[model samples]
Target chain A: MTEKVSIKRKVKCALLNILMYISCAVICLMLAGIAGYIIYRGAGGVTVDLIVNKPSLLKGTIGILPNILNTLYIIIMTLAISLPLGVGSAIYLNEYAKNKRVVRLIELATETLSGIPSIIYGLVGMLLFVQLFKLETSLIAGSLTLAIMTLPTIIRTTQESLKTVPGGYREGSLALGAGKWYMIRTTVLPSCIDGVVTGCILSIGRIVGESAALLFTAGMANEVLGIFEFFKPKMSGSSLTVALYMYAKERGEFEIAFAIALILLALTFIINALSKLAAAKLKGKGSGR
Target chain B: MKRAANFLEKAMNVIFTFCGFIAIAFVVLVTVFLLVSGIPAIKEIGIFNFLFGRVWASTAQSPSYGILPFILTSVYGTVGAVLIGVPLGLLCAIFTAKMAPKGLGTVIRNAVDLLSGIPSVVYGLIGMILIVPFVREAFNLPDGANLFSAIIVLAVMILPTVISVSETAIRSVPREYEEASLALGATKTETVFKIIVPAAKSGILTGIVLGIGRSIGEAMAVMMVSGNVANMPSLFKSVRFLTTAVASEMSYSSGLQRQALFSVALVLFVFILIINLILNLVVKKDVK
Candidate 1:
């Protein structure tokens, strides 16, 4: 009987061990397969002409220059608006807020904002920015919508880093006759720069990956626009992700879509590496202190 | 110089306070706008018909505005994704937290991060090229773009969240429990399964809730693989989710059709709010 019980235990343990090994293998293989397939299919379609010139009917040539430019513009516009607002909110919550109830409410609101989906952001952006605010279906409208969406990411990261700042630093600055804002600007903010950078990289990843949010607010007009033209209320443009949707789903142009996917995959890789590096640096600092 | 510094401090405090209120203001704005735009259509269609009606042909001559199909599809797809994703993710988390060596664990964690960072559109593109055709040929169905493919895509998309969150939870289980279990002559596997897992249960539940939120909100990927039809959902049937229903038609929809899409969004929002509340409760319990 004891021998039989021992055998049963061995069988159960072996079964669980096999399951774990299989699960890990499945995850690793999925990533490798997806990345390998995309590179194999998409590498041949990427070219200088595709990256530099706009699509032309006369030449029968396709290009993504307009979409690329629009992506850059939206990224810049979104960061410009959100960075200050997000960082300020974090500072207030971490440094200045006295009431615990108020802090909890703001944190709850931020959590709710993060939980709301991008599609809902798109709908609200259409109603508020595009129609009520009269920005129309322009890049500006899309940027504003994304600004709100990314706020939670920035605030959460910044608040976490702020928490790690040693209390001695703040108190020391105050003892040396530095005002609260001055102390934060000179000492607190500089030390937590890694967190801010990580926040920025994560937000950029979200903006680049976004499609459903931009589809309605930023209409799919691929005409290349100048810097001045970006601010025009009527100027509508499509980012690379939206363009990918149109090419693959609407136009049956899979080659172009795959090429765009390759670019996005590259961007994702770079963003992931940079954010990881920043987080590691933050950790190193925390331990050193 | 002293007066100027004091004035600067006061001004900066006001500015920061205003910035702090921005999050609350935006949440209020989103709720108000979705409610105002979404209510009229529900009223026009009648609440009962809008929620429970079986048909959703919004562009037909008479234009029925029922969303029962989309609601059912979203529910079914999310549940399907959870069924496939949770077990796989939990197993993977166990490997990372308790089984693997340090170097291999870091490599797996980084891979999971990269998986999470990949764009949704890229997932859709790959699904369109690969999964759709495979499903069609395997099932011998007329069309491969169905709820099954959508669920497959969603399961993959939610894996990173589930694995990462669960791994963190599992790692936080106190070492004392494992030591005591071993002292009692229980094997390592028994200790991990019977003691550690149960202790980490709330954290794992939080991850599952988060994955549900992500899979339910997904639009472009589901739209690409699911063949965007307003049919009652079956395992192999082409279906439209609440998200895809709004996305596929928002551009060309007019009048009541447009308003009804907003109503669909409102319903999705309410579902998300409920999920968020549950997540909060789970997290609070974990903290306690």
Candidate 2:
């Protein structure tokens, strides 16, 4: 009887563990279901006109061309600015700086900045970028705000990647009579390229998902603009997030909003997949992936 | 040539150091800017009242700058989200790091990575369309958008952060600890809870705190389902948080009202800063 009870207990424990695993799987399934639902509602909405034409009430259709352009523009600008700043700070923290206190301070402050509410960042942007600097809701203003918003992520990830570089590599380069800058440029950075790239992709993912900071700085306009005229005061380009917001805010626009959400989910899934792919490749080549 | 290169390298080091200093300087500047602008409202509505008051109204004659109501709402939203999020996220993390087959673990981790990449606004739209209507019908309530709905949505949004961090923390635990537990005739569950979890407690706590910070800082999605009402939190009642309060009012607000909005931000900033500092200190101790 005791032997039977012990076997029963073993079976119960195994079942319990499997049940726990299923619960975890349910969360991921819900997210995937959300993505699937979006694609189902939006597949028919994808068209050339939808990607290029202006939004019109008469047609009962909303094209996301302008929002797409703005998102791309802001993303490019954010990367351009943050990449150098983030990588430079990481290098300085890991390779050059000897003092530990200053490094700790930077680490602490960056984490705090990362945690600061994006709405606060928006408020700060309103004060410094829009009012004080008189940028007046231009693309440049929006891009700068986003750059700052994602800065901590970029810096933290880069710093993590930099820290992963083995100390022997740096010492080996130095012992070969290479100068400090040369050692960092050739040995340290080359060895950590995978990490740096991971950081970049992560920051890009963040930029693509951001909304609060862009709301105030990147004025909401759904109209596309000429190359040079994109920064005009009256021009408004709604990003995927902002556009979905406008749709949800207005009554009788649920279908369009749902469709846009579906597209947004697709974009997110693709970016995330690409980031994972890149990380996998990089890690396979460098580490024991 | 070597001497010249050394001088050049030293100069480069100084320049890089100065640049890092600038990033730190920016943080200080941001804090001071928030506090300085918020001073006007702080003076007008005494610090004690502003922090303690429950009402958040702005009018010409008798402007009210109470943030207690909003703070309670923000706190509830965060706590509610975390309550639902942490366990599920921790479970997923443990499954991915220790329990799952290799192929299944990769799929689960990738799914989480994708979920994290989805924008908050997109999440809001999802909440508005699916969660909102379903909630309204199921509860037989007046409005679909309420604290309950907000909590559900926020939980979904924060899941990825918690899961990712916890997985990393759990994976960092030494395998020998688990091996020894198994060899001692402990069941897998016992081994995991008694050995693995205790060893990774600090990292797991860090993950939870980081999730808190993320949930607290989130504005866009919470703004959508929170119903934007500035009242005490009820499961079925609509409420506005500190973040949604600022976003909804900032566009049209002027004078003391605008400053009051900044004050709300200052309050939130200080709150999050304190949490981050504590988290960093805790993590620092563990790292050493």
Candidate 3:
């Protein structure tokens, strides 16, 4: 009876181990398959012409220069607005806010904001920015929407890094008679700058990956727009993700879509690496301190 | 100099206080806008008909605005994704947190990060090119873009969230639990499965909830693969999710149709809010 039970247990253990191995293999293989297939299919379509020139119907040329510019403009605009608000909120939460109830309320609000999906953001942005504010389906409106969406990410990261900053630093600055704001500005903020940087990189990743939010708020007009044009009302421009959607879904231009996907994949890779590095640096700093 | 410094401090305090309230303001603004815009349509359409009506022809001559199909599709798709994703993700998390060597674990972790960072549009593009056609051929169906393909795509999309969260949970299980199980003559696999995983149950459940939120909220990828049609969902039929329903027709839709789209969004928002509450509860319980 003991021998029989041992054989059954051994079979169970072996089967379970195999299942775990297979699951890991499946996940790794899926990642490999996606990255490999995209590179194989998309590498050929990525060329100088595709990157540099604007898509012209008269000339029958396909390019993503405008989409690229739009993406850059949106990123700059979003970061400019969200960074201050996010960092400020983090500072207030970590440094200034004394009332735990108020802090909890703000934290819960941000959590709810993060939980809300981008499509809802798109809808609200359309209502608030485009209609009520009369920004009129422009990149500016899209950036405003995205700034709100990314606020939670920035605030959470900054607050985390702020928490890691030794309380001694603040107390020491106070002992030297430094003002509260001055102490935070000169000492606390600089130490936790890595967290802010990580948050910035992560927000960029979200902006780059974003599409559904921008679709309605930022109209998908693939035209090369100057910097000034980005601010003008009704100046619609499609980012690369939106462009990829238009190409694949609307135009059936698989080659162009694949090329855009490849570019996005590359961007995702770079952003992931940069953020990982930032996180590692933050960790190293935390331990060193 | 003292006066200037004092004034600067007060000014900065006000600025930071205002900034801190910005998140609260934005949340209130979003809720107000969604409610203001979304209510008009629901009132016009009547609540029961809008929620439970089967047919949805927004552009038809008479124009029925029922969203039963979309809600059902969204529910079915999320459930399907969770069913496939949770087990696979849990197993992978266990492997990463316990079974794999440090080097292999790092590789898997990076891969998961990369997967999460990849844009939904790229996933859509790939699904359009690969999975759609493959589904068609495999099932001998007339159209490949259907609920099944969408579910497959969603399952993959939620993998990173599930794996990372569950891995963290599994890792946080006290070392003594595993050591004690091992000392009791149980095999390593047995200890991990029977002892460690059960201890990490709350975390794993939290990951599952998060995965549900992601799957339900996904729009672009589902929009690309799921043939944009208002149909009662089945495994083989092309159907539209709540997100896709709003996205597919938002461009040219106007009048009541446009308002109805906002209503759909409102419903989606409510679902997300419920998920968020559940997430908070789960997290709070875990803390305790």
Model-by-model DockQ, in order: 0.78, 0.64, 0.80
RMSD of 3: 1.5
RMSD of each: 1.5, 2.9, 1.5
- Report i-RMS for every model: 1.3, 1.9, 1.3
- Residues A140-256, candidate 1: write the lDDT tens digits: 999999999999999999998898899999999999999999999999999888888989999999999999999999889988999988977878999999999999899989999
Please identify which of the two predictions, 1 or 2, would achieve the higher DockQ against the true structure. 1
Which residue pairs clash in candidate 3?
Answer: none
lDDT of 3 by residue, A177-202 (tens): 99999999999999999999999999
lDDT of 2 by residue, A119-209 (tens): 8888888788887888877677777777777778777767777776778888999999888888988988887777677777777777777
Q: Could you tell me how far off, in angstroms, the CA of residue B143 lies in candidate 2 after the best superposition?
A: 0.4
lDDT of 1: 0.94
Q: Which ten residues in a row have the lowest lDDT in candidate 2 chain A?
A: A1-10
Docking class of 3: medium
Q: Sort by TM-score, best first.
A: 3, 1, 2
Stretches of candidate 2 exceeding 4 Å from the true structure: A1-19, A56-61, A164-179, A230-236, B1-11, B59-61
* Cand. 2 TM to true fold: 0.92
Evaluated on CA atoms against the true complex, candidate 1 attains a DockQ of 0.78
